[model samples]
Target chain A: MFDYLRYIRERNFPHIWCSGCGDGIVLKALIRAVDKLGISRDEMVMVSGIGCSSRTPGYVDINTLHTTHGRAIPFATGVKLANPKLHVIVVTGDGDATAIGGNHYIHAARRNIDLTVLLYNNYIYGMTGGQVSPTTPRGKRASTAPFGNQEPAFNISDLAEAAGASFVARGDVYHAQKLEKLIVKAVQKKGFSVVEILSPCPTAYGRRNRMAHPVKMMEWLRDQTVPVAKWERLSPEEREGKVRTGIIVDVDKVEYTETNDKLIESLKADK
Target chain B: MKKKRADNICMMQGNQACARGAMMAGCRFFAGYPITPSSEIAENLALSMPAVGGRFIQMEDEIGAMGAVIGASLTGLKSMTATSGPGFSLKQENIGYAAMAEVPCVVVNVQRGGPSTGMPTFPAQMDVQQARWGSHGDRGVIALSASSAQETFEQTIRAFNLSEKYMMPVILLVDEVVAHSTEKVVLPDPGGIELFNRKQPTESPGEYLPYRETDDGIPVLARFGTGYRYNVTGLCHDETGFPTNNPEKIEKLIRRLTDKIERHRKDITHCHKIMLEDADVAIFAYGSVARSARRAVFLCREAGIKAGLIEPTVLWPFPSDEVLETAEGVKAFVVAEMNLGQMAREVELASKCRVEVHRLNRVDGRLITPQQVVEKVREAL
Candidate 1:
């Protein structure tokens, strides 16, 4: 068994998440994936924006940067471009990635920079007391949306694909073991890779919706998602609310830093 | 016999000189969003950086640009970003974050006419106060200004130096006239230029404290991949670089952020003074307006109204003591700038009501002529 303690800052450990919050599950999966890859903690930089999920960096003992709200992708981009040797991973949430940071998200994908982004989609804003988020399902109740959320939810994995991410995948906290595998594959890929994990904000999101208990939220995740292989066999009508949990898009492209390095080399040769 | 100019001397635009200066300062990374009157700095670096094996990224937005600069700086690289008023406003939040986290980076703001998108193509010295107080906080700020292309180049290098020394963001305030103006600059040899880098901890990784206070109150920071696995956040953090709610620790951290700069005001403050001996009227100016003020000084003297000029390259930490001392001998001050009256207020405060201060302000997006400062000086006397 891999020792999770080696990767975590044990001193800062009375973790801030609620009992059933899936942030912990995602954190553990991320650690397991990193440990399996055998990447030294020193070479991995964990950059995060403001959210409960963003707090994951503080617990892990690597070179961590807790940056401003919605700016983690740009920050990670700089880190990667500055020292391509460092493996830059950005941890962000639905609101942090899709709403305030929507432009950066799409642009990073467009550049196809070498970044592995682990975005936690918790349906609602859990940090600032359960506000309606960009990923909040239409007609779901929230603090700001006392009346049901009238806005249509975003399919983030599809958004990444449309934005030109070299690799895009979806996973859920309920499928923790498989989620680790997905993260491993995303980190192993070259250009911009996005792994959107459907995590539960149990205290804030679950309490407002019908699934107040942590187990209930887990069960809901289990019911709403289908394996990619199984989902391909299902008809459009049969796939009503079920999301496919696997790689949605994967293709090869020249990474941004590599392209930039080539340009530098060509200029040197010309001189 | 006449002397020959060095082959390195060339007519370089202010923005291009500034970009070249960054490269000379060992800056390895630049991230910026295009804004009017300041886009050339980014454009020049976009081409020039690749030649030098440096990185230049045009980010999606101003906030992202600021964030990227800070991120690069933490990786132990000298980094910078340039912007105008509207973009500067968008960058304030992360600028504050850099101050709090003690990241060393340079932010260049080319002053333009504005409360909003006031004047893109025109010149104005409106960001003087904003450079000092733009970001929300009690954190210390160091801002430098330049009146010519040559000065802009030199100050760009100094901006990076101060940022690295203090481990905080330094603002390089340039006006549109200076940024776009072309002037002759004899680029210095790399060996002759003085540079500064952030202090790294000598302690082993286990004993390293990224925020541990030294004798100067500035903490040494370790680069990310150098085996120092520490946490850096915008939150109030302790010496170990992890967030803490302890009031004493928070108070110490906040005070040190400012005290580190304040204690070294002598080292950080820079002022350029001209012909004040046997003068009755002194002209206080900075950025491009100082060019007119210098001409006005000679014009005032030709008219037998003895005059001199005080041009501050370092605008913040305001050099109040020097101004206050100069105020004692001069009977009056003529404050010339492109804004309504930003630095004029500072002149008044520095003079402490002892000497009469008159303003020569222009907000019509035109230069304040030498005659205008002569008139303001006459009115002040």
Candidate 2:
């Protein structure tokens, strides 16, 4: 853990996150994935839209951009297209990605651009005082929805898959090691990859519900989601509410940057 | 249409000239949406950008297009985007972001009539005010208006150079008339023209601070891939490029961002003055209306009235010094625009209530004619 100190920006530390926050765990899992991949820090470009998760770029030692709300995907697309050598990572929140930046997300996936997006789904807007997000579970309570959330929650992996992502996975912060492995696979993928990290936001969504404590929320995640094999083995009624955590899809496709590169080459050849 | 290397003295539209000028200025990335009057710029870049080892992408929306251009610019490539009123409105958020981040890029707005999608194919100079105060907050803006195809070509290159020089976004503002009109233009040879690239950091990654200011307010920019890993945020940040809530730091940062351009106002201001030396009545105009103002000056001269024109190519910094200097001698001013007295207010401010300012405004999405300007000047006379 001490050897990986170079990846962290210590000067910016004692981060502004709340106590017992799962955002830190997700950040650590990302750091471990990056370290394990052995990619040079200088070659990485981390970009994010506005939110608590977006602050992750500020605390990482890399070429980073903290952009406007729901804008990280398009910004990362520019970086990836301009310099294909630099690996682009997009860190986003549920509201940032699924609600406001939904167009950029689906288009980025449809184009199969080479970007690894780690979506930290705390099921609520932790920053800006706890509003219900697009991924907040149905009937969950938030500041904006004190009675209960009336909107249906999004299946993030399913959204990405439908949008033509080459790699799509869902992980829980409760299983940090396995989450880190999914991030590594996402990083290694050739085209647009999405890894949904079901992070606990005890300060926002959990407190309003029955799981007021961070431990309780973490335990809920552990009990609710099962392994992919076990999930597949269960009957429809038995598997009703369990969220499966693992890589859902992995395949090869021509990345958007390479397609543009080929076009550039041909245009020059014709010239 | 001529694809030859030694092509010159060829007929071209103003939008095509702007696209060529952008190419001449070493812009390698273009991201734009298809919008009326300005769509030709995107069409030209779509075919030409790839041929020159550049990239052109038709993004999902104007905001995304602006976002992509900024992204490409950060990777050390000169990038640009073109749009009309509706598209331009959508791009304001990112344009403000570019201003706050000090990202060097160009945004070309071919003006049209609009409160919201009002007129698409018609000419209007209504965006003159929006160009400066369109984006939120206090920041310096560089906007150039072109009256002809040749001027649009030259101004596009100037826009890119000014953007690179100041490390901020520059706007090449034209109207439907200027954008769609075709004329014979000679693109300057590349050897004869000088281009400026961004200045890079002297130190390596560990020792570098991306927003460290020099004597001039411009900071040394490090592109994404060259290993000077640093942070860029829309939030008020310090020299280390990290967000800071300190009031002192925020004040200093914003002042420097603006002071860098305001201090260089002399170099930034570019205008054309005709017969204003000994004239009592002067017509203030820009973009397509400037053409009508020139003709009005000709008719006024024919009528033996001492009417001159103050036509500004650079509109944002507003050429306040020149306007004030001209206001000293002029008795009354006739301001002509496609909209109702947007820029005339600035003319009044520069005049300091010394000269009588008359506005000849139009909002029917039609070009303000030379006769109308002549009539307005006659009324002022």
Candidate 3:
């Protein structure tokens, strides 16, 4: 844990994230995961796109890339393919990952490259002052949705599973230790892995909805999420309105780099 | 790997020759998509890269391809990406990032007709302007246009050298005709060729700035995993690689980008000057059209007309000084290209002297033949 603290930029402490904001919690969980893996700090590369969650790379002490909006996955893919020795991680928000950059994210997962994506889903664009995001619940009030958000939110775990990610998991900020454990597992996995952390935006989404304090947001998260194993035991009615937090998908597949290398070798052998 | 002395002669397309050149130049990584005329380059790289312990990746699209090449270059490997006009357009943004980050990489744009997918199978040099201003911001680029398969091989080697020397992207502009047309080429002894690598910083990690300008206006590039802690960004940054909005810093940064090529103009720029000693008629051309103009110049001189050809090998810097000098006493100049009069505008800009510059334009997706150039020169005369 002390070694992991070296990766954090102490100058950026007391981050701009509002009190009880899920982003900080996610960041902490990520750090703990890195520490648990005992990966060399110099061998890590953190890439991010433009958004509140994307700012996570700026606080890390590794080879950090803060790229344009919604382009972090491609950049992370490039970094991984370039040097397979390095551990590449992407920290992106729902808007940055699922909206404009959705194409790249899906294709990257389809290839199943060795990359770990930490998606901080706060249900709104926190940096741009809480505009309705792709994951915002329908009928939720946002700055852009004065009345209520009418668009259907995406379930990221399902999307990752469908896109061929070898490892997919979801955890809320309130479940900090569980999130850390899942992140560690994803980092250790040898193919495309994504850990969706449902974070709270107290200032924007929480305050506006009158669940303004950190304690109330934590209470809501604790009550709204169910464990994945217990999810099947619960009746459909009981699980109807809750987010399931656990490793939803884990399987083995040939990674992109390894497959490409083998294909090239076979072609050369035939020649 | 050490280069061995050999003279292997073969009849191959210009694109194949480029692939051979890249292999000889120690390029171990190639990421590109298949596009008309330029697909042969990618295909050949796919077959040849593995033989030399290299890798080739056909990415999902040109954007990802170019990004992969940039990423590979940062790993201390020579890397390249090949594409045509539309694919080239998709690659421009990342090319700009490579430039701003001082990454050494090569981009080959085998030219084709296009506003959007104009001619897939046909030939055109319409991307001359895009090669200069395709990306968003102002940055220096080194572009070389090859006239034949032999030059294609030679220029590809030079492209790698320039990319490494300047820590910037070097464009190899080959029109569709030259790219696909077969010609007998004599392979040079690789042992005799010169290769350049990007200069590494001598300063300590804390003292180094990724974008710091040297006396020659070129910055030193440190490969990733070198413990150089220097930041790389697309934004306007100071020498230390930190973002800065200072007007003076921005001005100096842009100036360095421009001046690095401009200040070394004499040494970097290359062009062919023929029969300009006392010639009254000149034909300015490049790539396939330049080859046609060379033959036309011979025909014109035989007909008692003092005609000459100026073929620009370095396209981006425009070879302005040579163009101006070569056009000094000429009564008329004919600019022939496989495009809608792109380089003709540059010739007009350089040759400020009132020489009647007639353009022999061709956008019909075919090469501008020697006879057509001869006729245009005769008409201008």
Candidate lDDT scores, in order, read 0.92, 0.91, 0.85
- Measured over all alpha carbons after superposition, the RMSD of each candidate to the real structure, in angstroms, is 1.5, 2.0, 3.5
TM, chain A, every candidate = 0.98, 0.97, 0.95
iRMS of every model, one decimal?
A: 0.7, 0.9, 2.6
Most accurate candidate by DockQ: 1
Q: Enumerate residue pairs that collide in model 1.
A: none
What TM-score quantifies how close candidate 1 is to the native fold?
0.98
Q: After superposing candidate 3 on the true structure, give the runs of residues whose Cα lies further than 4 Å from its correct spot.
A: A1-5, A9-21, A124-133, A139-150, A202-220, A260-271, B1-7
Model 1, runs deviating above 4 Å: B1-5
Better of 1 and 2 by lDDT: 1
Mind giving the per-residue lDDT tens digits that candidate 2 earns over B331-362?
99999999989999999998898899999999
For model 1, what is the C-alpha lDDT against the true structure? 0.92
Residue A83 displacement (Å), model 2: 0.4
List model 3 lDDT by residue over B55-96, tens digit each: 787777788788778777876789999999999999998888
Clash pairs, candidate 3, are none
Pitting candidate 1 against candidate 3, the one with the higher DockQ is 1
Model 3 docking tier (incorrect/acceptable/medium/high): acceptable
Lowest summed lDDT over 10 consecutive residues: which window, candidate 3 chain B?
B224-233
For residues A7-97, could you state the per-residue lDDT of candidate 1 as single tens digits? 8899998999988899999999999999998899899999999999999999998999999999999989988998989999999999999
